[model samples]
Target: MTVGPTSSTWTIQTRPPWFFRRVVTNAAAGGSVYLADLVTPRGMTVVVEPAKISFSTVAFNLIVEVDLSGVGRVDDVGIKSDYIGNHGYLSWVELNGTHVVRSPIVLFIASPRT
Candidate 1:
């Protein structure tokens, strides 16, 4: 795990059983995406339920879907539109319904630390 959105906040880093490692704060009358750094693995016991993000520069195509439900296990969710004039083209990412295979899409993990 390695979500991004630094400078204002929005960072998630995990490796093992997906413990806890969070930091997201992009203000602008917008907030709610927290999960401090806990990195579990010693005894393994994590429970973080926090996810709420609404960001869109207005150009279409900025999909973020995070529903960890509990525990840990999120593989291959994609979205990457280099900085330029984005034309939009990332049309799939289903986590609990199958169809998952796309990488390089930064920003958007709403919640996943349980």
Candidate 2:
């Protein structure tokens, strides 16, 4: 993480994650959940892994701004991430609240149907 003016303003850089992972909100997301409420957050990223993210929070108004360019957004993404970093962007994905972490895919070996 690199430091910048006034200590608070920093330029943090983290190495891309080694393994490919998926991050997403809960499956029971609906009802009052509004995708329009989702704002491009600031300071951090909205992603799962192998992505670069940044963020900075303001203590006064409790406002967060996010930028996740190139990464793009996928609706109903079945993944999880610890990038919450005190930001509400991830939380906004699901109206029920909180996200779930799971393996992107799983392969099951079985005898071929005959």
Candidate 3:
């Protein structure tokens, strides 16, 4: 929803790694769901994918940090079920580690109209 910068430090609540895997796989399978309580720092976008689900998916929750570059952070991030389109960013994140990726916020931009 076009989040603006904030002066406070943003801490994203952790979710079960399986949750992320499911979301990513569902997205790849053309399924959609509401991504609740996701968060990231400002000026960054986090992308998740099924194939890239961490090996610790069933063991430990995957937490990756994004450098804010001194900009405000983004937090309480999520993607609505209706948001699904052009997930190229997810693909990019899957191919590269979060360290190389700048954005730390996840979103589904477009979805099929019901």
Candidate 4:
């Protein structure tokens, strides 16, 4: 599945416990769960890996590792993403590496069956 960011402000919601498990499962299986190809406003596309993913009472935090050193971190912190049927949503996000802190949205659409 594909994921990025969407808008500046996000309305967070609680998700079923199974949701995180599914995401982790997919990632553990060497899938594309954390393959967030975040495109910056400057037209630079960077791939990120989820360093720490955890869901709490009100929202969740996704701390990702960026490939470029000193580029800063990509934090979709205190946000929510959902997986419904074959589609997924990366609703709220923030990239703090740069001073601008652009919000890049990500969509997780399942790949076609081979």
TM-scores for the candidates: 0.19, 0.17, 0.18, 0.21
What is the C-alpha lDDT profile of model 2 across 1-110, one tens digit per residue? 11111122222332231232222222332222312133223332344322222223221111223333322222112233423222232223322435322121111112
Model 3: per-residue Cα lDDT at residue 91: 25
RMSD of 4: 17.7
Error (Å) of candidate 1 at residue 85 is: 27
Tens-digit per-residue lDDT, 6-97, candidate 4: 23332223121111211222112121222233443221233345632333322233444443211111222212234322112222232222
Q: Which residue ranges in model 3 land beyond 4 Å of their true spot?
A: 1-53, 56-60, 70-114
- lDDT, each prediction: 0.28, 0.26, 0.29, 0.27
lDDT of 1 at 35: 26
Provide the global lDDT of candidate 3 against the true structure: 0.29
Worst 10 residues of 3 by lDDT: 1-10
TM-score of 1: 0.19
lDDT of 3 by residue, 1-114 (tens): 111231223333232221222212222222222222334433344433322333323223333332222112122234345533221132223232222222234322333467
Q: What is the lDDT of residue 19 in candidate 2?
A: 32
Task: Name the runs in model 2 displaced over 4 angstroms.
Answer: 1-13, 17-40, 48-86, 91-114
